[model samples]
Target: MPYRHAWLFIVTLICATIFAFWRTYFSILPEAAIGFHIHGLTASLWLLLLLAQSWTPHHGRIGMHRALGRVTFVAVPLFAAGSMAVIHSMAGGTVGGDPFYALWGARLGFIDTLALGALLYAAGMALRHRRNVRLHAGYMLSTALPLISPVFGRVFNRTIPGLIIHGPQDFPVFGLGAQCGNVLAAMIALWLWRRDPRFGRPWAVALGVIAAQIVGFETLAHSAGWNALFLTVGTQPLPVLMAFGALAGVVAVWLGWRLPEARGRPKQDA
Candidate 1:
């Protein structure tokens, strides 16, 4: 039981997600885009899955934990598809030169890409090291990091006064809200790594990824080349992009499961 209170963390994240998207998605669910519906449903299920996975093993229900773990084979692909659908939708928004999209949409799209990459990386590592309890749990728990920013960033934007100051063209001058959320995520990862440095490689990796994400948000998001690349990606068919994302998930799961366990690590029950 590496993360003894993991269920608590997952539950809190679920609550934060609901609060963050209440006005935009939950309150107007029927009117939301198909992509949003897909993303929301899959993402919520993923969190609930994480909750069950955490609770079962900690409660000495290893059988149930293994059963639930199989769900990720299907869940990961669907989650990835949903994520790509939302990314496509966001990219499409940058088409008509809306000031918000022109300035912020590309940045958001870039960040989304990084977040998705981080998710896949964490998931893959978790599956690959499934036999080593410490590594497996650490990697599995790290999956939650990619999700923190999107949830809390919205919360900050809406709750904190002047967090997202507007400038000319109604563009956001300071994206303090999202930055704060990312900083919080990084802090959590760093704290986790500090708790058990000997068995904290996964968290360490997560911390590096988050740091890269923050740096990319500030630098790569503003790059002319990245903006152009995102705009090009936006022009492609949504279905194609989603299909590619789903394929990546499938490949990650297959490869991770098939890979040999690390040397010198004894197999441990979930």
Candidate 2:
């Protein structure tokens, strides 16, 4: 029952995603690669699942909520696969010397890897704390945080005046779009944590994840070693990379769900 109005926020994010990817994905759906289609469909489904999950419990449909929660066991692995597919595609582009990829793709790929890590952490925590309603809800909701940057960064690139000025190399001098998005996500997490500062481990963890992403983006993403690693990953078959991602998701879910509950935690409505 926490975050009773969370569906509204999820809806807004869905809208933002559509607006941000209209030109690149939605509008040119036919021209987009298979990886894009997989990622787009799975991502949209995850958001919709979140929306339903939020609304059902708030509307006194606890049974429905529990039923729908079972779907995540299947959905999450597919989501992971889609995410890796896109990352693999980006790496290939970078290796192929596409102008945009040559400059920014590696960095974005690295950030995305961090984002995936954050998502898996949140998902695992949510499952592990399922008996504590507040903790479970907090971690479930935190899943949205990792997705904010990819959507809003594009929005900033399109809408914010002078937000991304290209340099002589023809890429933005700085990752202003990503920075703005990360700042916004951090503020939201901080605000949520402040609201329940005494027992806000979920939000604190979320904040830590975001901070790691920010630091990684500013430093490691630009490093020669990271780029080399990414290029090596790119050389692997796309299906192999996607399978690895799917396995990671499955392992996270299994381990989290199978773990013993910690002592002294208060039980809450599921």
Candidate 3:
């Protein structure tokens, strides 16, 4: 798709994120923690980067776009790091002091990090194939679907509280919201795949990841082994979190550099 068409998705994402976090992020005296601010700012930077990259290419500034693309190697990891920080902070206290709540938060955070890592890996891989710009764009854009799940999940909890099943002890509002997000993402992926089967690969990969994430979240929510793992990770020091972020960053960069440069021949079918 052309930048003009793609720009709509970018705008929609920006608007949705802002609206979702309006009370916490956009307030005059926002009471959110430092970690949230870091996460929010970094996430916003990524979206802005996407917007700029899209805008430049349409304006006949391919050089500028490529330059901005280089910065992604640095920005992508920071985005990942900030995300982990937010998750850790939330898991630490936001869910209350109960051990089960803490375990649930850790589980959610771990799965979220995995999802983000998978999408980043896919996006980086897509970039290596310049010929399949549609596929690349599909991978890049699909990352937002999961990223925004929490926002919509919280919204659903407050607005349509009883539509979904709640967990035995605590309300599983976020999980329901994420499930709704997964379904929406799957629908979008299917629609795009049907539009051009040639562009289906990335969408297919993204859908697969989303499916696995949902399955893992559901199956392991009550597993003793998984909770133990989450507890270990959740109790780790700041250095460990930083190390995990750094390792994920390295993997993303390695993936970006793994494949040879594309021949630049645009696929005729897609």
Candidate 4:
């Protein structure tokens, strides 16, 4: 609750969203622009909801948290879908679009997959730690951070081209905003984990996935002929999406089964 920077982060995201709208700051076409805006707004709303729940006194969490959590579960995947659409539409149409596509198109897919994992983890943690007051709250809070991909996508939204961006031409070398977010999340998650080591494991799991995407995206993007391979890989029909969704759902439940039940607490805080 003493995290002033966290409060500031939500505020910063709000302002960035405003600028992104007012000045057409993201340098995208109308359709892609709409997709980004919608996703960004939903992502911001989700984060605000998280902040609201987090700052609320425990006694105050009677039902709002549960309602908000349910809404977030439905909301994030839609955002992920919109992001996928935006990425697909922009593959070679705009400046830096192709390169960024080549560099990180699979990233949206991978992180979207991570969202499913986080959602699964959130569901289990929500139940397993329901009785252990402190651990449940902290773990659930961190788990939610990664559930919505905007934090990563949005980070790169403002960060990639820098403040003085002139169209999308200069997205070369990518950007560090997404990494900044992961590091911040890891640090805070670790700080909270010091209060209980169980928190450390999931934090590590989520953080590890985030770090992996950074390497994974660039690696695939840079590999010769990977662009063509991914382009073909990405050309899935609705049946494919549905099948993968079903398979992913099964995998999520399986992971939910594997997490240890919340049973203990740290003896001291870091």
lDDT of 3 by residue, 99-175 (tens): 43554575576567667777577657756665566756666666665664565655554457473324435454456
- Deviation from truth (RMSD, Å), model 4: 5.5
Better of 1 and 4 by TM-score: 1
Task: List candidate 1 segments past 4 Å from native.
Answer: 164-174
Error of 4 at 62 (Å): 2.1
Off by over 4 Å in 2: 164-170
What range of 10 consecutive residues in model 2 has the weakest lDDT sum? 165-174
lDDT of 4 at 184: 60
Tens digit of per-residue lDDT, candidate 1, span 1-270: 678889999999999999888876899988776767878888887898899999998789999999999998988888888888877766777875656566677888877788778777778888998988888888888988988887888778767767643344324743567778889999999999999897788899889988988899989889889988888877888788889989988988888898887887666633
For residues 1-270, could you state the per-residue lDDT of candidate 2 as single tens digits?
Answer: 688898999999999999988877899988877778888888888888899999999898999999988887877887888889888878888888877778788888987888788778778888888888988888888889888888888788777777643443525643788878888898899999999875588889888888887888889999999999988877888889889989998987887798876878787854
TM-scores for all candidates? 0.93, 0.95, 0.82, 0.62
What lDDT would each prediction earn against the true structure?
0.82, 0.83, 0.66, 0.51
- Cα deviation at 258, candidate 2, in Å, is 0.5
By summed lDDT, the worst window of 10 consecutive residues in model 1 runs over 165-174
**lDDT top scorer:** 2
- Candidate 3 lDDT for residue 161: 49
**Pairs of residues clashing in candidate 2:** none
